[model samples]
Target: MRIFSTILDTVTQRLMSEPVRHDPAALSRIRRAMIDLMPKDANWEDERLRHRLLVAVDPTSLWFLRVELHQRLGRSVGEEVALESVQALWPLFEDSIEPALLGKRPGRRSNNQRGDTPPGR
Candidate 1:
């Protein structure tokens, strides 16, 4: 049993470290699933949208969304784009997941945060 456990652990670690390659068909299917699951004309400001995304969407689908977005945008898969893509794909999730996952919005600058550019400059 101990040997079996060790083997399982080793396999799991290797799989986790490996990068996932998503084919075009797989990406298409994932996008379809996302669209199907999305609630149309529903109030996005409600917390239920965030909860649904967290619970309904599987981890694999989410990962593929990020990868597809990064590749399509021709940007390196960094933490910022990885997250921004998700929000862009699902506006219902905007301002909700980012604050919780990243502690703030990416690429959004407040007027005060912007360097002094003179009033109405």
Candidate 2:
């Protein structure tokens, strides 16, 4: 599992290192799909932010993310994407997408998502 994730992360990083001018709608759809596919206990904030940064800040990762999002969009619209359209993306999502998320850690919910404030803050 870790090996798979490492490969995916490396690929994602490499892809994120090019120029992408993707549509906002596609991104929105991707966000929605990701939300649905993700486990509720997954680290949504970090992974979501990372994906967004890949699209906005990193040009390399853009097309792959867009294509992945597009495939999910196609499914929603009852369209079918060709296999070659994005064969490499799903594995990465399965493996590398949430490397830091293994399950809800202690206090994660209370400290991060809940309204409760941390002691330092």
Candidate 3:
């Protein structure tokens, strides 16, 4: 069992360290989808994020932005809606990010973790 654990750790590390090659078109599509999800009455925060997404040159930047994007969606739409929308975007990152990273939404905390229910819940 110890040997098996060591092998698993090694494999996981390799997968985490391996770089991904993303297609330019895929990036564009992801940027577009994120922008489209922005609320119509977008504030400076929205514009700032939009610009970031537009100028992002790597999957890492976009991946980090997912948290902010989910927050914006939750504030504007709702938690359920935001979760669904963000989950929909996960496939777009499948080819450009590690599967381990994409396994869960970033910045999310369950009611037990947060000690408070989500808005409208």
Candidate 4:
């Protein structure tokens, strides 16, 4: 996982270094996406601020963060990018956002906690 993270980090950095990163519209789009995707809870304050800061100081990290968030929320990269509005993506991620805001891995909620019957039952 560390190796994969490293490779992703490198690639994201390279991609972010392109001329498109300097475009005002592109930057606006990224900022809007970050704000829209961030959970509305105090628990995620630090993480949200960190990502916002990265958008200015290290956009590659911000890009990777968004990618991870999409993955954890179970949205394909293509689907996420293809959406006409960031709001459209939020509903799809509603189930996973709380866990993510609480610093927990999404989808780790057991069936028992979700009130679902056990596998053998």
Each model's lDDT comes to: 0.44, 0.44, 0.76, 0.47
TM-score for all models, in order of appearance = 0.24, 0.25, 0.65, 0.32
Q: Mind giving the per-residue lDDT tens digits that candidate 2 earns over 1-121?
A: 9999999999999989874454555544444544454333435454664456444532234434544544454554434432323332343333223323323255555335321111222
- Candidate 1 residues lying further than 4 Å off, grouped into runs, are 1-18, 45-121
| Candidate 3 C-alpha error for residue 28, in Å | 0.8
Off by over 4 Å in 3: 1-21, 104-121
For model 3, residues 1-121, the per-residue Cα lDDT tens digits are: 9999999999999988966577888888888887888889978998998899899997767877888898999998999898778767766777776644654346654332321112332
Candidate 4 local Cα displacement, residue 20, angstroms: 8.1
Please give the RMSD to the true structure for each candidate, in Å.
Answer: 14.7, 18.3, 9.2, 14.6
User: Positional deviation of 19 in candidate 1, in angstroms?
Assistant: 2.8
Model 4: weakest 10-residue lDDT segment is: 112-121
* Candidate achieving the largest lDDT: 3
Pairs of colliding residues, candidate 3: none
lDDT of 1 by residue, 1-121 (tens): 9999999999999988975443545444545544443434445432353344344344344533443344433333455544454445443323223242332347655443322122232
